[model samples]
Structures are given as C-alpha cells and as structure tokens.
Target: PLQLSQHRVREKEAVKQSGVKTAKVKGVKNLEEIKKAIDEIGYPSILKTCSGGYDGKGQWKLLEEKDVKSINWNENVEYILEEMIRFDKEVSCLVVRGINRDIVSYPIGENSHKKGILNKTIVPARVSKDILEKVEKTSQEIRKRLD
Candidate 1:
C-alpha cells in the first residue's frame, strides 16, 4: 500500500451571503448554539459536517432557523455546522504531495447541483476570463492555508 500519513480534508466552505448576519452563528457546541445559528442564518444556509459531514452530505438547506425551535430537545447534539454562502461558482481544487516530494494539482472544476445534490462537474472550467482570475486567486489563498 502507498504510504499515507494524512490525506484528510477538513472543510468549512461557505457561500457568499452579503447581507446575512454571520455573527449569529457564534458557536457550535450544542443545540442552543445551532438554534441560534438558525435564528440568524434563516432558512437555506448550508450546514456542513465537521468530520462526518461527507462532501456536504450532512449539510442542510434550512428554510427557517426557527424550525429547530419547534422540535423537542431529544439530545444535545448538533451537526458540525456553518452558514452557507451563495456563490456564482462552486469549485474544488486539490494539491497532493507524494513521498517523492512531488506536488500535483488536479484541475479546478466548475460544479453544478440538482436538488441539492452535486450533479455535474466540468474540469478546467470554462469560466469568463475575469472570473477565472478570481478563481485562481481564491484557490491560491486556500492552498496557502492548507500548507
């Protein structure tokens, strides 16, 4: 088997919600905090999993944060959560380093969704010249953090 130490990707991807009150999502320890986030983010903000939230699966597009207000507290559990941002483009870029210290980057992909499910992917996305610059710049920032 290939020597693998750690290749896990921890994600907290957010959509751009310009007018949304992001501070409303203060902490993510228990039900109360989650409820507060709902109250603040309102419905349809994607909530991602901290670990088990595989590829945004545990994610929910809540329509009303108060939806939790109506549910009885069965347990003090919460999904690892965040407020989803609305972005014109959703993409993923990966950088891999082999034991040989060789680094490779998979081509960036332009993503699409169907019923909240990832549907299609276009590698080497055909974005506008202007948007392409923005994507490259943003991807660079993310790579820096991962390093």
Candidate 2:
C-alpha cells in the first residue's frame, strides 16, 4: 500500500501544496535553533516527533517563551516545531479503497479533544454543508494522490 496515507507523508505533501493551510513547521538541532524556531513559528506552537506517535503522546505545546525555556531537548531524537492552528471545531473522515480502484468515504465525524486526547466522536459532524463537503473532498483527494 502507499505510504502517503501516513501523517509524515501528508505533512510533506502539504508543505509543497497550496490549497490546505498546514502549520508552518521547521526542524532544529540545538537550543539556539529551538529559540530561533520559536521566534519564527511564534508562541503557542507545537513541538512533535515526526513518527511513531498516537493519541497526542509525543508532543509539547509552547504556550509562551517560558515553555520554550522549560524544554530539555534530547540530542538522541529528532523534532519538528509547528505553529499552532486555531480552529473552532475538529472533524475527521475515513476513506477506504479497494484493489479495483473503488473508493468509499464515510460521513465526516466531529471530534472533541481534551488535553490532546480524543474524548468523543459525533457522527456526521454538526458543521455547515460547505464544511462537510470540504472534509469529504479532502479525504477523497488524499486517497487519489496515494492511489
């Protein structure tokens, strides 16, 4: 199967594209670089690993400069800093494709997160028609690109 379905792949593709607005992100090697990244990405940014994470476990939120100073970077690991995005609601969609080129997408689901962990899912998110359409379209587009 195509690996483009992964978060890392999606992020790289987003960096090259123009439609969706993804968080501005950068990698750093040392504390000085981390400071520079904070200046560029701004406060309320997020620092996360590029792989092997789920349920929001491998990330840190920099709400202020103090949070940045509080961090103790592990030289053994790699990290990426991303500007935090402000959104009213979070929604997700699931897409499945078969070997015969058949694709199917489920209704968009509204996601409620607390402390970065998904707390609830409301099927067919209570969003406007336009937003729902956009979410579904995006899911389909991702499958197409990976296909």
Candidate 3:
C-alpha cells in the first residue's frame, strides 16, 4: 500500500509516471528554505507536510510573501511547496477493483474544497463527456500501475 499511504507522493509520482502535467512542487526542511522555494515558485503556492497529513490537517496556503512569516514551524517535520493550480473545476475519479482484477469505475465526482478540506462531493459531475473520460482513464491507469 505504498502508493496509497504516501498521499502526497502518489499525486506527484502518478502524474509524472502517467505523463500528466501536474503542479510544480519542492520539499523543504525549514521556514527559510520554504521562503526561498516560494520565491521561485511564486505566490499562491501550497505548503504541505510530505506525510502523515490529510484533510487539510497539515497544509498552508501562501497567497503572498507575508504569509510565509506567519508559519509556525516544527523542526522535526518536513514540508512541501506546490504551485497553486488554476482549474476550471475540481473532480475525483474512483475505481473499485476486485481480487480477480475485475475493475469498475464510478462516474467522476465533482469536488468542492473549503480551506483545502473537501467540502462537498457531487456524483456524475457536470462536465463534458470528454473530460469525464479523461478523468476515468487517468484514474484507471494509476490503479493498474499501483496494483
């Protein structure tokens, strides 16, 4: 379950291995390093712990340089900075596979986030057929490779 356990790593590595373009990211060990990385990544970047974080528990949104100074750092933890993505919409694709390798995918679900926490999910997300297909295909590819 390495892929699933590494919540943040899977996102980056899946997009990379699948040849899908994703946000740029960097890992940092301290506040100073993060500030420097942000300068290169620009404002509106995301700062997240590399592991053991989920549901907005260990994430910070940096909309500006001043936001960096406000961070309360823990010397023992690692953090990652990611460029904020400007998306037309947010969606999640879920796939279920049995022990026999039979797989089924659910309709893409549109997602809403409030302060980086998933606020709502709507099935059969309102989108063009093409977008839905792309989402499912990508999800399936990831599942296959991980499996």
Candidate 4:
C-alpha cells in the first residue's frame, strides 16, 4: 500500500512538521537520479525503503553522498529520503475509543522494542510536566484524527 508518489509527497509534510531545516531527495528513480536526488536532499538523509518495512527496519542512514551506491537497493524500489527524527527518547501512547464513541486516554508511556518488536511499556512517564502536556495533547489530537 506504499504509493511511491504519495510517500514522496508525505516526506515534505514530515519535513515541515519536524520544523527542522533539512534537505530531502525529491523522487529518485535510478542511480543517476539517486545521485541527483541526494544532491538536492544533501547528506545525512535517511534512505528509507517505503514499503511495508517498519520499526527501524529496511532503513539506512547515509551520512555522505558517496556511500549511496553501497546500499543494495533494487532499481525498481523507490527510496524515501527522510531527515532523521531525533529525540531524547521515543514513546508510544495508547488511547481507547469505545464503540459508543467514548474516549479514554492513557498517560504517554515509554516504550522499548527488540528487533523492531514492541517489548514492554513503562508508565508514569518521567518527563517534564510541560513535555508531558505537549505529548499528551498531541496524542489526543492523533486519536481524534484517527477517529
């Protein structure tokens, strides 16, 4: 279900949402285009395989343009160049929305994954009150979007 065009378009949204001034490869196809794409995106863009790959899987972070060829990418498979989403920690939120349209929000919980599989959840997140409110509000917004 990964549409090539859609992924490229979404990358822009991701870049803007991140609010980080980073470059991205715009629609790369072959080696020649990849090289050009990398030039546009600049170095340190994550070369992400945009299929069903997930949870840090099928992703490669290329720091330099020269190393782009070393990655064994299928000529047909398009790659999405994404800016690295860095943070002090990564967390997940679970919000329950009942069939009756009732919403119950859980506290944002820290998460740990092994080989891309979620392993455990740590509640009572040890983040600042401000950060907690920001994350919590974001989680609620995400749930609303999904609803």
Name the top lDDT candidate.
3
lDDT of 1: 0.54
How accurate locally is residue 122 in candidate 4, as Cα lDDT from 0 to 100? 82
lDDT of 2 by residue, 1-147 (tens): 344334553465553463554678887656788889888888888887666655677788999878877777777666778888999999999888768968788888999988998899999899999999888877766556555
Off by over 4 Å in 2: 1-10, 14-18
Computed on alpha carbons, the lDDT of every model, listed in order, comes to 0.54, 0.76, 0.82, 0.65
Error of 4 at 85 (Å): 3.9
Is 1 or 2 the stronger prediction by lDDT? 2
Task: For residues 34-96, write the lDDT of model 1, one tens digit per residue.
Answer: 767666666565554443444446555655656555544334434444555666887766667
* Candidate 4: 10-residue stretch with minimal lDDT: 1-10
| Position 1, candidate 3: lDDT | 44
Tens digit of lDDT per residue, candidate 4, span 1-147? 123224654545454454434444465556787677776767677776656556677677678866786888688786677655556766766778778989887888887777655677788777788878877776666445434
Clash tally, candidates in order: 8, 0, 0, 0
- lDDT over C-alpha atoms for residue 100 of model 1: 92
TM-score of each: 0.65, 0.84, 0.87, 0.66
Arrange candidates by TM-score, highest first: which order?
3, 2, 4, 1
lDDT of 3 by residue, 1-147 (tens): 465447675567666676666788877889778978887898889899888888788988899878888889998987889999999889998788879978888889999888778999988898999999889888877777666
| Stretches of model 1 off by over 4 angstroms after superposition | 1-27, 39-44, 69-78
Model 1 — TM-score against the truth? 0.65
